[model samples]
Target: MVNTSFALSSTTRRRLSLVIGAYTVVVFATIVALGVLSATASDHAPRDAWVHAIIVAVFAILLPMRLRAASRGSLAGLRAIGIISGVLFMVNVVESTLSMFPVWMRTEMIVIALLMLVSIGLVVRERL
Candidate 1:
């Protein structure tokens, strides 16, 4: 019985780790793609470009930390990051849509919003 319990616990840990790892990889890839798209654009507004760069940087920094938190079964830290990212993403979307931003800036905003939504979904799923 003890052996069975230990095995089950170990399996759960491994599964959690895999989920976190996958999430991190996806987030990092999305951020990098957005960053590249933003950096290469010629007609972006200065404000929009700055915002895009900042959001991408934040995601780049936070993805690994989020994975670590998830691996440790700490949902609070992930949730906090998700909420902040989501809010910033929404703000960027609104700004890019209403402002006279370039196509690349608009696309980058959309990408960031999607990334934030994915993070929120992952964190919620983990809680449930």
Candidate 2:
């Protein structure tokens, strides 16, 4: 059975936005927290801080645009969200296992990864 329908239900769209919104908030909070922690400690690496900064920036831009596109029934937006979520999920999982970050930050990576997983599932279900 081939399903060509790509329209996501309003409920699904709302849930997707909420999940992404939460993930974005958490990512921003983690970066802010890292900044404060780094300010007080000499152990944090500049490279790691820059990596997190870039992640936060990407999420900030994508969140709004993707949500708007999805609401408008854009398949490209849904596809992009799915691919981005899958890629970020892997990135977060790898980050969570790294030794240099604080345990709390690593835990936060896991949380973000879970959100990405949910996002992947949502988009896949809609597309299929």
Candidate 3:
């Protein structure tokens, strides 16, 4: 049997790691920005935005790394982050929907959350 399976080369892995790390940094920055912007709005504005920002930060940190690990045939990281990220995303969506934000932002969040779910499904199919 000619085992034709291939793996990502070390150089490719390292490059991808760098890009993913940069993406993570950008996501974290957005979270911080949201929190800071929230503080200037109104009484409930900061609270809503900050809460939304923090949960999103949690999702932002976990999901990408977990998905990366899953793609390499490891279920451990995926299991750890999948449930929590999914829950946080859903909670954020629901809370944001109920909060003082405009309907458009709430809709955007729902779309983001759905995309996260799709990623989770891909991870499960690929690595588990």
Candidate 4:
């Protein structure tokens, strides 16, 4: 059986929570803003709304899982998820920029970048 007994200091846990919460808020806000802007700029199509809904759903699920994983001291799991999320977020920004989406999307992209850096830092710090 795999030992899942990794534990984090209280301070570390709190810090991690702060980082995760900030990332989640920024991501969710960005999604809502994009959804609203898209609805306003384009005719409300089922497909567009569906895409937004899917993004929102993914954010909803991933954010909680991230928090839970961090709290449980699953550093490996958190880092893996963070890397995947960061890459996907960066891709989303690149696609949006290329597709002529509004400049406001950059805000979310920056947040994701910061989160990615912090996650990498956390992974490294935990190793020492």
Candidate 5:
């Protein structure tokens, strides 16, 4: 059910935005780092890293638009952000477990997952 009456406070909304922005920065950084490592890393397939980076890049780009909508009190926007955050969390969890990337990258993935989890929680709890 859509909770039309639910509205995020400015502080809460800013927190959500911060989470989203931080996630985006981390994601782009991951992509850049992956690209740099892909040049010399022989332990993992460059194709896999590139694919993951591309997918995350798309999500990172989409977030600001969704945040704008949510900030405007659009329920669909809020739901979209929550859903994206949850999906990214799961993706990062899986990535963190893979042996394909270096240990440091995997650790970064763990950090990304945690951040996404926080974002998801913020969106979900506010809606609730």
Candidate 6:
């Protein structure tokens, strides 16, 4: 049923949702582990680390809600999130590729870009 309407089949949607979910989990674990280490070891908080952690933490809460909306067949919501996340990831990928980030970081960016591109594909698939 999902496949008929979107580029992503139900299985693919489920898998991608799981991937996003896992990514969120990793975000939290990184924060907690880093936070604990920083608390015990550092006299002052690292501004950059805290900012990055907080941002990813927000994604931890938001992405699942968006995925739920998307999985529930909300076309408008899906399109909005899909396009926004897709373009954001695409831009990040290009930026990372051109930046001085190491090969591994660029590779990770590419992977995330692929996932978001699939999401965008699903959004556009509705019209095809």
lDDT of 3: 0.55
Give all TM-scores, in the order shown.
Answer: 0.57, 0.86, 0.56, 0.65, 0.85, 0.61
Writing each residue's lDDT as its tens digit, candidate 6 over 49-86 gives 45645765676677678767767766655666666666
**Better candidate by lDDT, 3 or 4:** 4
Clashing pairs in 2: none
Give lDDT per model, in order.
0.56, 0.78, 0.55, 0.59, 0.80, 0.60
Q: Candidate 1, overall lDDT? A: 0.56
Cα lDDT of candidate 2 equals 0.78
lDDT, residue 95, model 2: 81
Q: Report the poorest 10 consecutive residues by lDDT, candidate 4.
A: 44-53
Worst 10 residues of 3 by lDDT: 3-12
Query: How much is the lDDT of residue 101 in candidate 1?
Result: 63
Per-candidate RMSD, Å: 6.9, 3.0, 6.2, 3.9, 2.4, 5.6
Decide which is better by TM-score, 4 or 5.
5
For candidate 6, the TM-score is: 0.61
- Model 1: per-residue Cα lDDT over 29-120, one tens digit each: 64565566557853533554555565555655665575566455555555565676567567767865866666755765676666666655
Off by over 4 Å in 6: 1-8, 43-45, 87-128
Model 5 error, position 124 (Å):
1.7
Better of 4 and 5 by lDDT: 5
Off by over 4 Å in 5: 1-6, 40-45
3 or 6: which has the higher TM-score?
A: 6
